[model samples]
Target chain A: MMHPSAGGVLKPACYAKPLLRPFGLAWIVMMSVAATTQAAPEALAQVDPPTADHSQFEPLQQDFASGREVTRACLECHTEAGKQVRASIHWRWEYRHPQTGQLLGKQHVVNSFCNNVTTNLGRCTACHAGYGWDGPDFDFSDDSRVDCLVCHDTTGTYEKAPKRGGRVLQEPVKVHGHPLQPPDLGKVARNVGPTSSETCGSCHFFGGGGNGSKHGDLDTSLLDPPPALDVHMSDAGAGLECSDCHVERAHQIAGSRYQVTARDRKGTGAPGQRRYAATCASCHGIEPHPLGSDPAALYQGAKLNAHVDRIACQTCHIPAMARGGVATKTWWDWSKAGRLDADGNPVKRHDADGNLTYWTRWGEIEWGEDLEPDYRWFDGTMRYTLPDQTIDPSAPVPINRFAGHHGDPAARIWPFKMMRGKQPYDPVKDRLVYMQLFGKTEQAYWQGLEWQPAIASAMEAAGLPFSGEVSFTETRMAWPITHMVAPAEDALACGECHARDGRMAELTGFYLPGRDSDPALDRWAQLALAAALLAIGLHIGLRILFHRRRRHTE
Target chain B: MTRTVVMFTGLERLWHWSQALLIILLLMTGFEVHGSYSLLGFGTAATLHVLAALALIVVWIFAIFWHLATGEWRQYRPTTRGLAAVVRFYLYGMFRGESHPFNPRPKRKHNPLQAASYLLFGVVISPLLWITGLLYLGIDLWSAPADLPLAPIALIHVAAAYGAALFLLVHGYMITTGRTPTAHLKTMITGREEIEEASQREQQPERG
Candidate 1:
């Protein structure tokens, strides 16, 4: 027998006593079944089930017109959540590096993909956690603008209109030939729960304008990865979501690219301990290999454990990035953009693999599937090339210089998805020029197909000087390869890095036994060995001749 | 008159043959680890090399104890006496079909030159190889002392490996210098060697 009082839902005032018991019992049973089917076992284990039946809440039950209206109602209960989120990097899009004191984040850094976010605020802010960030004057202190449902909505229908400054549209609209239907705001608000990979990936997975373009390690495939692709996040494996590793506290997420945990010696924390890092060591610990009872396994384990100090786990574990049937944008040539057909319309080209190779406005893009990552020595800190910073045009400029070397004790050899590009730079100023790549205005590069107006307008908006002359300069950005980790059995074999022309061949300042050898030493050793063999052969030859001569004389 | 004498004990022959097998295994695996040629693959070569080295160390421990306990250590106590004659015989007299300047007996198995070379290999080369090999294997256990990085250790280990190879090659050739080409090998295998009766009569009882 079900107790009517035990039901989470409140009995409506108009319901009669007889109807109340059955209705409450039926509602409870329906919710229980829904919860059982909706949440994965691992997700339920990590996150507590929602205690509040939000459908019964008076404010959420209303027909919400705007996202702000829903946020206001959410603030009525989660008062401090708004303030906490408003101060987060997701909202501010700014992070002042602790070591270098250089301000970086999505807001300040100019990426090769689409350049700066300044003139393309409406398009870029669609991913931002806040609302109404269409211009520089958008209020940062306004708590009501902080989006609660974006990260917390269990209703998968929640979506921000791409060009509407992170606002959920009330009316249906079409942009980029894809239909953008308005989400049921009341249902989304009422069903708000813990964030999952789907929620976090709604923005992150689609960064750099399209899916799997910005980060090779992150893609839509990670939403439901298989064991071979990512053992931790796979449904058949740990089934861990983004928040399981990128733990959040008071709206502040743990992981950041600006300051990476390149080498973690902290090891796995004790049970119930708060973790603030998404490093492999934080979960796998220092000794990750299995120390078997047998001798051979013990030897392998010890030898592998020895490498933990110098090599980051991802160097071997990840094997390759963009491995889940999604090709990552590896090369971008903005110089090749601005191509128009005979009709003066923008041109688009697709490759044999159905990948977009060229778009008139965006330029040529080279895709890579299951690509090997470039290795580098990294010690967490990354110094960015700020918009105002000058650069020498002699070589490819690094977008963010990794602050580490072979001599640095804290540094380890890390794997990175190297995104190489050729973008416009001011010849006179010797600095990278920002372009208004998106907008409806005639000055926008996508609309006008003119570089001068776009660069000038974006530079003016960013309060930076842009020389009239522009020249394309090669640039490189290194995104640390830390996700899509393969299983242990699929780790790199010894021969992969131990050969003469192997993965570590380009690495200098250190010596690897099979890969490196001193030519002079080798030549001398060979000579000495040959000499010894020759002397032994000559001595034996002389002895045989002497014995034969003596026998003939006798 | 030539007569067969007990030149090597059972334990000494066991140690010699087993040590030879271990060294051969070590050489094959060691060169592969140095990236000379990949026969058994690097991982397998490295593992086998360590296993052979460990086995060699165990054999050495037993051989050292046997040598000390039976007073056989005196055979390798290097002496200057007859050392010049032995050196000169190998350099000039051997090619001229001259008889060996040094004779082998039950108590004194090695010539002066052989004693000195064996002493150098036993005390210096062998110890160096073992210590460096262990250090290489136990690299995870200790932080290398200042001024001594892993490169030098690996280099020294390689150099010592070359020394071991040379020792094996020279030792192989030197065994052929016996009265018959296979005489020394036969003696090591059978624990007996044909020697002059007068030299055997002159042998004193061994003392530790």
Candidate 2:
């Protein structure tokens, strides 16, 4: 019942306490003036009063030595929690696509950003939900390995140590010249509650090495986003949590990019009726717009609603991705890696905006903000080009291809963040090469700054034949941009897609008025108009000349 | 001797002006929707274009019923009587200040040439515009074969619109060739015009 800041309101030490939680609440209350004025009691009712405070529990009183030990303590009360977490895609990191029958997920797919997570498990596993996933031999069956605090910690201080197999930093350490203190395990364990946007954003937001670098629509800005940034998540709007739409049941989230639901023909569900699908149509009906008295407004709304059959709501609503301040990585050139200055030390260069544009360990990087996404017709199925798949070196390889055509009934035009990169591939073998980019091994690219040795070692580790020929092959990966939905007023105007050289210019197969025109027909129409004008001009000249002659003769 | 005579009824004048306004509005908005140039935005222009088309339809319905009920539909009946002479008068004699090949009457106002042209407008141009416009506006409601492209339908619609535009330009010029430059314009507004007293007496008994 006590406010966290009530003890020392003016004390400097009180400032050190996490301001993220209480500051988020204060910002929500301040931003939602309309809500407060309309229904103060309803706004207060939504504040989730905690039912059971873990601070009074006997088991959490003792300081925990490791994340596994805390997980052991959590198992005493929530017996099936560990089993549920372990069975999830977050823990297994592997998914066999039902349609394609290809082994996918972080464990298999060769991404354009960091390549594969095989040799880079030590570092990439920092985002893993379990402990000690540094190697492929890690036990997936062990229930105690599930790091419950990562998702449940309400203190906002729990962090998994990077490159240490998902372990918590047991001692104070300096990272990238910034001092970080080890989380007080006892305090975090005692304050455990439901998962928050912060908990999910900790790993998801920081994907592809940094915040807002991977998914253009997701970032730390969403923690307390203004309504203009995202009406669904913002306080003044729906104020929905991540789980509210993701709809996690038994720790298996409902929505995923791997198997997208491009079109929801079922429309809106009944109030309080549970649905497994997480689609815009599931909540807001297929025809979400209201028909009003004004015919023009009604036409606009109706036209927009009818577009749901072939166009996604996000296509117009999320006009631009990475909108709130964080710039997403658009391009990465791994071919430019291993560049060094006159000195032997690793080189790094920052851009005018202080963004790391180049680094010896990675390569040249390009960042983009408030960028319009490339659109394509997607029908829920995505087939990836596996490592063993033969690729044409002459053409840019699509790392993952979205499946659909304009004729497909289920297909709809969806926006995507197209990540382009030039990564190493085995030219002779015609396969994408995986390299060990992390760890202390001599073959590691980060440690040795060499690609040949790194690729050879990784290929050997994965039991793939190395052709000893490395070439930079251009690759493209598409991540669907569906979040950061703007308010209705901010949605794209009709002219955005209905004019010449508009947003759908690249998309072919169907005719769109105001955009598509038959050149021959247009030319003929102009000629006909000119001919009519010529006839009229001649007739007028004759009439005027004849009248003058008659008057003179008279 | 010149005498003023009733050329058009008040309802006829109203119909003519309203139809002209609706056609002009439709043409401007339709071209904008065709991406020619922007005046009102595409959404607004498209909406206005549809509304104007609907207005044109209502006006046409009332005009058609009025023509049929008042037995004035005979005015536009195609007849070869003096048709060739009326064509010749416009082609050569009009430049020489020769007399017109046909005379106007209360019950029969159009010349042979005018009647033939109006017949073409009614049977071909008007039908083309109405059918194509309706099809273009209600395309979504057509649940026909998916392969049926809208390009052909749109092409016909645009072509009909161009035909209407040509008619407008010629009609504007023709009205100036009346007794005076503004004679037809004034008569359309006031529903009356100066005529020869002999021609008035000749046509008066038929008006009864």
Query: What DockQ do the predictions score, one after another?
Result: 0.45, 0.52
> Hey, what RMSD does candidate 1 come out at?
9.3
Interface RMSD of each: 1.7, 1.8
* Tens digit per residue, CA lDDT, model 1, B81-132: 9899889888878877766777788899999999988898899888888988
Estimate TM-scores for all models. Answer: 0.88, 0.91
What are the clashing pairs of model 1?
none
lDDT of 1 by residue, A403-430 (tens): 6776787899999989998999999999
Give candidate 1's TM-score. 0.88
TM-score of structure candidate 2: 0.91
Whole-model lDDT per candidate: 0.81, 0.81
